[model samples]
Target chain A: MALLTVQDLTMHYRTKLGGVHAVDGVSFAMAEGEAIGLVGESGCGKTSVAMALLRLLPDNAQILGGEILFEGRDLVKLSEHEMRKVRWRSISMVFQAAMNSLNPVYRVGQQIIEAIQQHLSVSEREARSRVAEHYNLVGLDPKLMDRYPHEYSGGMKQRAVIAMALACSPKLIIADEPTTALDVIVQDRILRRINEVRAEFNMAMMYISHDIAVIAEVAERIGVMYAGWIVEMADTVSVFKHPAHPYTIALMSAFPSIKGDKRVLAQLPGEPPNLLAPPSGCRFHPRCPHATAECVDEAPRLEEIDKGHFVSCWHPQRRSQ
Target chain B: MLRFVGGRLVQIAITFFLFLTVVFFLFQAMPGDYTKQFIMNPRIPPAAREALKVRLGLTDSVWGQYVNYVRNVFTGNLGLSFEHYPREVWDVIKERLPRTAILFLVASVMAFVWGFPLGRYIAWKRGQTLDYTITVAGVLFYTIFTPLLALMLLFVFANQLGWFRTGGFLTPRLWLTPPSSPQSIFIWLAATLAGLGTWAVLARFATRRIGHPRPRRLAQRGLVVVGVGLAGLGWWASGLGPFAWDIVWHMFLPVLAVTLIAFGGDMLLMRDSMLEVIREDYITTAKAKGLPDKVVRDRHAARTALLPLVTSFTLSIGFVVSGGIVTETMFSWKGMGLTYLNALLIQDYPMAMGCLIFTGILVLVAHLVADLLYAVLDPRIVY
Candidate 1:
């Protein structure tokens, strides 16, 4: 059985206009100790899905229909009290914007220790030891933990956040754009450290990011999301080499590769559909090159065309072409 | 930190000197002499009036008078009041300072104690009916005129209910007599020292347990003020020989009026600050850590939200020494507010200058303390 499975998970945000289908019918499963990247544009609901898995969505958001199963228990059905037990113990998150993700007034170590003491009945001294160990795991000096977030450089703060996420040895860690605010060199180093920590702990990870290149480097399996739906999910190598969904193909072609033939980067024609009043079919159909009348009338479902590979599209791209 | 404080002290000295110079010249520029108020009869000889002007140094040139004034101020003379003949300005201020200090101190404490938690709750419950109701109420209280509020409070509590005295710092029945015997004076001194010692111990513990240093430091300062104020009151009580509780009863209406007026702004400030802080990424991180809702709100959100309120609290303390002018006046409370008002009414320049100068120093010291507090509260803030 998979370590975590999100089935038919739908979430909506109540806004002035109407209910926004931010995470609509998103389904995926992660095996034990596996890493899956949820890649999408800014508004594609990848972050929403991460937040939903943790049940940390803002007050305006509602989990319309979903089942988040972790270790054979349905998390969506659990009370807030019960869910809190799962969070930080079973699942923890490294939030986006590392610069602001730690309280400014508190020392970084204090924040990590707070998380440790909250879930575990550890003495302050024991929690401090655990914080030091996690800090070392994330390649941050334990002494630097005494400093406030503003005192640390962007890369150091990101490492501190990763340390906080890893403090509890959670079964699953959701890293939501963890390195987005850092420089290229810092991002590379932080990502490497995250991979090392994950390997050591054997924890499942859901890496959410808009940058497919970063995801390609860290995620073993990749799920391509467009407008609140995962259009493709497969091993990273297969997804990159032979993108089955049209949206995935367009997204891949849009990036300028170092080794590929010199050509203008392919741009997807339109924006992600407005989830408040989404297009009445496959969300990517309007922007798809080969969208047809049937594509507009019927939404596609994720179907396994090959072992361990899924594609959601009315017209899956041919590998030969 | 020492260097920063030293620099601030030097700046305060310069500013105070300039203030003294300006105040002297400004009053000198006023039409008609202030000493004229001292003369009751026009039938008095011109020679007698001239001698009075010379004796008071009113006959000297502006430059000579300025020098004499600066020298006298440095020597702590503070000059004598023209309206209150033979009474020194400093003596008058000393007599009135404690009453004003206690009244405003209590009001400020009430404001902070009531405002902070209430504001934080409203912010945490933002967008709910409770938030809206409290916010509206806060706005109403904050915008109400000070004298009007004071009068309304006096009318309700003192007039309608008749539960407390309408005004005054003390009952007329209790005559305050200084402890003359050496043994009695020694006992009062020992009691005051004991109170100070107890406060010091509690303040040390409070600093350690309070977590955040800014509020802890504030609490420490507040503890000192309360301790000293209470000790002084105790000393007075001992001297006065079993006074009635009527003094406290009299203070109720004015303190309530002052607190009502001041607390609204503080609550609104805290609410707005907490609203912004709740949106910070750290709060979301705290929630994701499986911390309880209360922990997230208070520890993660409210701690950061308290930065602005720290500065505001310091500024409010600066105002404390001056007392609530309109509130004191409306309730007939004989605090520094009424003292300043009386000096201004009779154009008693010496007394006015002394009060204004003291207020200025307090304000300057408050800012310095605030700057120091910012560094303590947020490690990121450097002097």
Candidate 2:
């Protein structure tokens, strides 16, 4: 059985303009120790899906429908108190580290220790030792643990945040743009460290990032999200080698491959659809090159196009031809 | 840090001297002197008036008098008040300082004590009915005229309900036996507070290495409560109860009026600051840690939100030395503001300048203290 299965999870943000369809019908499953990368353009509901899974959404966010089956229990039906027990203990998150993610006034070690003690009935000494161990895991000096967030460089702060997320030894860790704000060298090192830590713990992870290349490096499976829907999902190699969905194809073509023959990077036309009043048919059809009359009038549900491969498009293989 | 403090002190001294000089010159440039009140009187002869001018130093060159004024100020002799003839400016200020300090400082503390939590809650519940209701209500109270609110509170609480004294700092009947002066009462209160504060600090330091946080915090709070209780009981048992009660009873309405008017601004400020802080990424990180909602709001959000509130609070307290003119006047409390106003109207240069200089020094010191507090509260700030 999968460690976590989310079926038809729908969430909307109630704003003055209207209900923003942020995460509409997002569905995926992760087995224990599996790593899935959800890559999409900014504001394509990747972060929303992560927030929905953790139930850390703001006041305006409303979960319209979903069943998050985790460990054979429906998390959507769990009370807030019960859900809190699931968080950080069973499932923790590594937020965007460079965006003041740690409290400015608190010691970095104290924050990690807090996460450790919140889940486990450990003394401060035990929590501190655990924090030190995690600090070493993330390649940070244990001495810097007592320092405030501002005292650390951007890369060090990210490492500290990663240590905090790993302190609890959570079953599943959702990392959202963990290295987006760091330099390329630091980003690569941090990504490698995250993969090493994940491998050591044999933990499940759902990586959220706009940089598909970064996700490609660490994620075993990749889910391509567009306009609040997962347009395609498959093994990383298969998705990269033969992207079946037109949107996925366009996304793949947008990135410059270092090894590929010289070619102009393809620019996908048009902007992301407005979620408040999203298009009636396929949310991506307005910008889909293979869009037809049927694509304009009817939305296609995600269907298994091959073994272990899913695509939500009227003409999934048309882009390959 | 010492260097920073020392530099700030130097800056304060220079600013204070400049403030004194400007006040002295402004009073000098006024149309007349304190002797103007005796202009229409025929009781004094010309020769006597000349002696009085000499005694008041009105006949000296303006530059020479300014030098003398600065020297006397540096020597801590603010000169005699013309309105209160033989009374020195410092003596008059000392006599009234306690009354104003007690009323305004108590009201300011009361405002923040309640305002901060209310603002935090309303911000946490933003967009709800409670939030809107409180925002509207706070804005209403904040925008109301100070004197008008004081009058309304005075009439209802003192006249209609007859629950407390109508006005003034103390009832004359209760003060007939002269239990103690207001200055002594203020001094005693300050000393007791200092003692309690020191005890609380030491208790916190004693428990700094405690393994468990929740119990340590509880014990610290318990110690403070016990300390305050003991102090209060000791004061009452020492036979200061009647004097204290009399003063409290008479000043209750004024303090309430001031608090009611003042807390709204603090509430609104805290609400805005909290609203901005709750949107920060750390707040979401705190939530993801599986901490309770209250912990996220208070520990993670409210603590950061308190930065701006601290700045507002310290500066407001600094202004306490200036005293509230409308509140004091409406309630018939003769504090610093009333004295300063009377001196200015009658051109009592020394007393008016004394008040202005004192206020300036307090504000300057408060700013320096605020900068230090910011560095302490927010570790990102270096000296």
In order, the B-chain TM-scores come to 0.82, 0.90
lDDT of each: 0.85, 0.88
Q: How many Å off is the CA of B169 in candidate 2?
A: 3.0
Which parts of model 2 have CA positions greater than 4 angstroms off? A318-321, B45-50, B177-240
Best by DockQ: 2
Give the Å shift of residue B345 in candidate 1.
2.1
Poorly placed runs, candidate 1 (over 4 Å): B35-55, B173-244, B321-323
Residue B62 lDDT, candidate 2, scale 0-100:
93
Candidate 1 lDDT, B1-383, residue by residue in tens: 78888998999899888888888898888876755664787776677878877877787898998898889998878899876778988877876666676677777778888999999999998999999999999998999988788778878887899887878755555434522432234334435555686787787777778878689888888888888788778756665333323455677788788788778988999999999999988888888899999989988898889999999989888886565677778888876778788787667778888888778778888888999999999888886
In angstroms, the error of model 1 at B299 is: 1.9
Cα misplacement distance, residue B137 of candidate 2 (Å): 2.5
Docking class of 1: medium
Q: Give the top-scoring candidate (lDDT).
A: 2
True contacts kept of each: 0.89, 0.91
